[model samples]
Every structure is written in C-alpha cells, then in structure tokens.
Target: MGIRTLVAMLAVALVVIGALATQESYKVFMPGLLQGAVLTIEIAVLGSLLAIVMGVLAALARMYGPAPLRWLATVYVEIFRGTSALVQLFWLFFVLPQFGVMLDAFLVAVLALGLNVGAYGSEVVRGAIQSVARGQWEASTALNMSRPQMLRRIILPQAFVAMIPPWGNLFIELLKSTALVSLITLSDLAFKAQQMNQNTFKTIPIFTLVLLMYLAMSLVVTIGMRLLERRASLGLARGKAA
Candidate 1:
C-alpha cells in the first residue's frame, strides 16, 4: 500500500485500540475525568481574568506612555514571551519562597500563566487600539476633547470592539496553557490525569478521558467566542446602519 494509505490505516488501528482501552476502564476513569474538567475550568477562568487585566494595562502603557514607561512595558513583554513557561512556573513556585514570599501552587500557576499570556495578549490589544482610525483622534481633538475624554468616549469603545476577537483567541490559548500548572502540583486537569494514571496504572484510559474532557471544554469556549463575535459584529453593523 501507499504511504498515505498506510498512515490512514495506522490511525484507524490506533483509534480502535483507544476505543477498546477506554471501554475497559470507563468506571474508574469517569470520576477523575469530571474532577479534572472542573479544575481546568477553574484555572482557565481565573487565569483569563488576570490575563485580560494585565494585557490591557500593558498595552495602554506601551501605547500611550513616555519613552521610559514604554521601554519598561516592552521589556516586560519580551522577558515573559522569551522564556519557556515551564521555567517561569518553576521559578515562581520555588524561588519566591527564598524571599519570604510564599504563594500557593495554584496562585503561582495563575500568576505565571496570566503574566505569560498577558505579554502576547498585550500585542493584540495594542494592535486593536492602533487600528482605530487616526481621523477619529483628529476629530476628537477638533472637538476640544481632552485625552481622557477622547479615550473614554471615542477611542476605547472602538478599540474594545476590535479587541474582542483577538481576546477570544488569547483566552482559548490561556485555557490550554493552564495544563502547565500541573507541573507545580496544582491539581488541575493534567495533574489529576497524572494522579489517576499513577494510582490506577491505567495510563491509556485516563489520558483518553482527559483528552476528551479538554476537547469538550475547548469546543464550548470556541462556540461561546463565535457567538460573542457575531453579537459584537452585529451591534457594530446596526450602529453604522443607524
């Protein structure tokens, strides 16, 4: 058979094997799977909230601040983005205790995940803000609008509309990255999956359940984001028409 056919057959065989393995241990796997889903949801929600806050702040500082402040923001973003997330997590978890700053594993994970994703998300926020037309700024200034007034009344509303789609994508990424928190013993989905596999010696079934749970959660987030995007676009369209 051709290479393509051989790969397809291999994939089919793997799927069949996975099906058989999962069926054999469904009872033992289901509870841990549910627990893992809840943990994953918790981490995603908390981390995304922190990330959004940090991202908006970072973007604002970078876009509107003095040169020194802008440089600082740029450095922050680069450092986080440059390093591996696993190293950041380990440092936060292990190093902070030396300075008399002790954060629980969950908190450290949330902070690290938020900071890491925030660096990337800030670029999205900055781009969205910059995409707002220069004419809008000039018109606002012509109207004798102060900087704060222009930002609040004319700029932010438009920028927020543009930011939503990219923010949604970043949120999905934040969801997946929460898996790394497992390394710090946060008892999130990946952690629980590891625990289950270790205790039950049923690696395949446990991992399969965890995979399905992640897929299901990601699907929900994707659907929600699509609906939000549609709503945001529809609102903008209606306003333009009016």
Candidate 2:
C-alpha cells in the first residue's frame, strides 16, 4: 500500500490497541485523554480561524493601506514573527496580568498561537498576491474596475489558490504549537499525557499513546489540507477555462 495508507493503518492499529487495553487502563487514561483532545481541537480550530482573519487583514493593510495603517501592520508582523512563540505565550499569560489586563488561559492560548501563526501567514499571503501576474492587474484596470473590485473579482481568487499550500504548512505548525498551551494550565493533549504519566507511571504506554494521538491529528490535518488544495486547484482551472 501507499505510504499514506500505511501510516493511516498504523494509526488505526494504535487506536485499536488503546481501545483493547485492560478496562482499568482504559478507564484510567482514555477519558482524560479524549477530553483533552477535544479541548485541543477546539483551540486549534478557533486559533486557525483567527489566524486566517488576521493574516488576510494584515496582508491587505501592509499592501494597500495608508502610511499609518501600513506602519502598524508592519510593526505587528515584525514583532510577532521576530519573537519566539513561547515568549509570546508567556507574555500573554504571565506578563499581561501585571498590567491588570488579565485574560483567560484559553483565550491567551488562542490569541498567542493565532497571532504567531498569523504573522507568518501574512507573509505567505503577501507573496502569493504578488505572484499573480501583472497582466491580470492591467486587464482589470482596462475594464475600469476599481481597485477593490479588481482584487475581489480577479486577483484574490487566483492568489487564494497559490496561498493554500503554504497556509496548510502554517496550519500544521500551529497545530504543533498547541502543546505549549499546556504550560499555561490549559488541559490540552500534552498536558493530559503529562498528568497521566505522573499519576500512573506508565511512561511508555502513556507517551506512546500521546505520540500516536498527535500523529493521528496531524495526519487528519494533512489529509484535509490536501483535499482542500485539490478542490481549489480544480476550481482555479475551471475559472481559467471560463
């Protein structure tokens, strides 16, 4: 079978093994882990949505906004991209409270990770938009289309296709970064694994399960992104033909 098929089968095998573990073991571990996994999924989904919004807004601001807006967007992009995500997390969770700007741990996790990933995503968007052929811009202008009209009708749809692959990579990176949220007391998958390991001392079994769980999640993301890319590509092709 193909490599993807093999990996998928292996993940399924591991999941089956987890399910078939002793009742005591299953009861001890599975509930907590599944709960954490749910929370992790929640965080990833919210963070990804925020990241997409921020990336697009920042990219548009930097490219087309007035001087003040461009400067602000530049500062945001450079600061977030230049710093460590961990540091950003710590600052949001630990340091912000010092200014009486207390925030919920979950909120901090989503904001920190979303903003960090978004900084990189902004660059991807900028590059993809730039990659669209200048001829398309000229043609749109010749049609007497306004800047926003041209961008909406011609430029963005094409750039969106080019943006998909890099956005996929950034999303995967964002998924991995969710582990850091555990440090701030959010019970994500990594936090659950550590808590289980400490309580039961089933180091190998617990960690191995955690590894498989993360792999399963990343695989799902990869598959979803690939499907999205394929669908976008087909749409782009059709658009070109028409």
Candidate 3:
C-alpha cells in the first residue's frame, strides 16, 4: 500500500526477472564456464586476505608507529594507489622476467590484486581507526592498559564495525577486477567467456552469462559481509555492556 512496500515489490520483481534471464544465459555457457568461475573465486578470496593484511598493517604504521615506519607505509600506499593495476600486473608478469623475477601467472595476479586493493583499503582502515572515540582511548589508558592491550581489547573491535561496509565494497571491486588476470593468460571467467565468443560467436549470450556469474559471486560476498557485520555489531554490543 505504501511507497516502501511498493519499492520492495519492485525490487523483488527485478530480481526474479534477472534470475530468469540468467537461467537462459547459463545454458549457453555451462561446463566451459565452471573452471574459470572457480579460479576467479580462488583468486579473489586469497587476494582479499592479502589485501586485508596489508591494509591493516599499512594503516597501523601510518597511524601509530614511528616516523620511518609512517614514511614507508606512505610510500607503499602512494605507489600502488597512484599507478594502474594493469601496469602493476604487467611489470610483475612481463618486465620482472627480464630481471629473473618471474612468478607464476596465478601468483602474479594474486599479488597485483592484493597490493593495489590494499593501497586503497589502507585509507578505509585509517579512517575507521580514527573514527573510534578519543574517550575510549583515554579510558583504556586510565585502566593502565598497555598499547597492544588497548588496541587488541578496545580499539580494533570498534574500528572493525565501521570498516565492514567499505571493505565489502572493496572486496566486490577486487572480485570484478579479477577479470584482468585473464589478460595474462590466467584462464579466469573473462578469458573463458572470450573463448566461448571466439568459437560460438555468441558474444551477447556468453557475456551475459559472465555478467550473471559475477553478479552471483558479488551477491555471495555481500551476504557474507552482512553476516560478518551483524556478528561484529553483536560483539561490540557485548563489549560495551561489559
């Protein structure tokens, strides 16, 4: 009856339409698409792990550590963020071979994805940490908590709540960006789709299939992150109650 209800119904109808369309598209590219989809997931998951680790470390160094540490973090973030991700992959995959620094294609893809996403992610981390209240820090200090203890016990848990939404967006972006790895012969979703188009000449349907596959993957990430956010929020609530 109301506008909110109407909007909800419209959204549901759109989802149903999309689902039906994807079903038709899936028949056009089935078994050939499976391996590429799997590899895409594998790359995205591992790359995201590396990205989170780097982002957190870089953020902490820039925020709380010594001047030299801050400078190093700054340089790392700036270099990766300033440069193109494709260029980073090219250097790692192509140029490095000349210097005998060759890496496996999968490894190169993973590292490039991680480092580039991590650079942008560092700012998210820094901002989340900064968002935690000053009073919380003072309270932890008043309790004679050590720096590490305060960070582990008080600061990080709260910062994590604020970090989830941005990190979710970054994760999905990283997943989509995995398509680039196909450029270097990684045989991911995009590459597989390219092959389908080359042989079948059904670019529209094949790419439509790829789009649905990516959308499915993104949905999974969104749902997982939502669960994580709920858990983090509950944990924060408990910590505050204590």
Candidate 4:
C-alpha cells in the first residue's frame, strides 16, 4: 500500500484503540463532557450576540459617521483584527486585574471573543450595507425620505438580507474560537478534554472526544446558517415578486 493508505490505516487503528480504552470508562467522561459542552455553547452564544451588536454599530459608524468618527471606527477594527486572539484573551484575564478591573473567566472569554469577531464582522456588515445600490439611496431621497427613514424603509431591510451569509460565517469562526477560552480555566470542551487526559492518562481518547464534540457543534451551526440563508433569499424573492 501507498504511504497515504498506510497512514490512514494507522489512524484508524489509533481511533479504535482509543475508543476501546474509553468505552469502559464512559461514565467518568460524560459529566465533564456535558459541562464542557454547556460552557462552550454559552461562550459562543454570548460572544456572538455581543459581536453582532458591536459589529453593526461599528459598521454604521464607518459607513455614515463624520470623518473623525469613521477614522476611529476604522482604527478599532484594524487593531482588533490585527492582534492575536490568544494574546487578547490573556490580557483580558491577567492584565486587566492589575488595572483594578476584575472579570470572571466567562466574561473575559465573552469579551475577548466578541471584540475579536466584531472587527471582522464589521467589515462584512459595512460591505453588506453598502451593497444596497447607490440608486436606491437616491430614490429614497427623491421620495423625500429622511436619512433614518431611508435606512429603515429602503436600505436596512435589504442590507439585512445581504448580511446573513457573512454573519453565519462569523458564527462558525466564533464557535471554534471558544476553544481558546480553555486556557483561562473556563472548563470549556478543550479544558474538559485536558482534565480527562491529565487524570486518566488517556490523551488520545480525551482529544478524540473533544474533536467529535467540536465537529458536531460546527455541523449544527453550519446547518442552521444554511437554513437562515435560504429563508433570507426566499423572503427577498417573494418581496421582488410582489
């Protein structure tokens, strides 16, 4: 057999061995896994929510604000997107305490994840909002619509449709990024896996479980995003037809 085939066979054998080893001790893994999953989900959900809100605000600032305001928004986006999330997480957890600001692990994770993702999400949101044609803006103005009214009635509705795909993409990234929170003793999936491996000396089995759990969560997010994308498109089609 080729090297690739040999490697695949060895990988399969390793998985089988790991599974067999962990099978008898399933009860010990279950509680930790459940708790870890909960923490993972909570971090992803809360972080994504904060990211969506801040991203929208940032996008709006960049797209419509005064020159200095836009510059500030641009700087914020660039700074966050430029830095390493792990570094940011560490700062939030460790350095912030030195400045007389104390945050719990969960909050620190949420803040770091949200801030990191928001920078990327802002660009997506800004592009989506801008994708509404220039003609549409002029038409709204010609119809004597105020700026707020134009955005509300003519621009935002369409922009939201465009934003769905990018938002979904950000969510997937956010979900995976939650693993980094384990470093801060958050008891997330990675943390649980580490704990199991340390206690049981079954690193391979523990990590195999972690891999599967991350894969399962990612798949769920992917399917949900696809559904949302379809719904957004369907709404747009129906509106156009009407």
Q: Comparing candidate 1 with candidate 3, which one achieves the higher lDDT?
A: 3
TM-score each candidate: 0.85, 0.91, 0.87, 0.86
Instruction: Give a tens-digit lDDT track for model 2, residues 80-158.
Output: 9999999999999999999999999999999999999999999999999999999999999999999999999999999
Clashes of 3: 0
Q: What are the clashing pairs of model 3?
A: none
lDDT for position 120 in model 3: 90
| TM-score of predicted structure 3 | 0.87
Clashing pairs in 4: none
Candidate 2 Cα deviation (angstroms), residue 115: 0.4
- lDDT digits (tens) for residues 20-80 of candidate 4: 5468655467678878999999999999999998898889899889999899999989989
For lDDT, candidate 2 versus 4, the one ahead is 2
Pick the lDDT winner. 2
lDDT of each: 0.79, 0.87, 0.86, 0.83
What are the per-residue Cα lDDT tens digits for candidate 1 across 76-162? 899999998789999999999999999988889889989988999899889987888899999999999999899999888888777
Q: Which model scores highest in TM-score?
A: 2
After superposing candidate 3 on the true structure, give the runs of residues whose Cα lies further than 4 Å from its correct spot.
Answer: 1-28, 235-242
lDDT of 2 at 76: 98
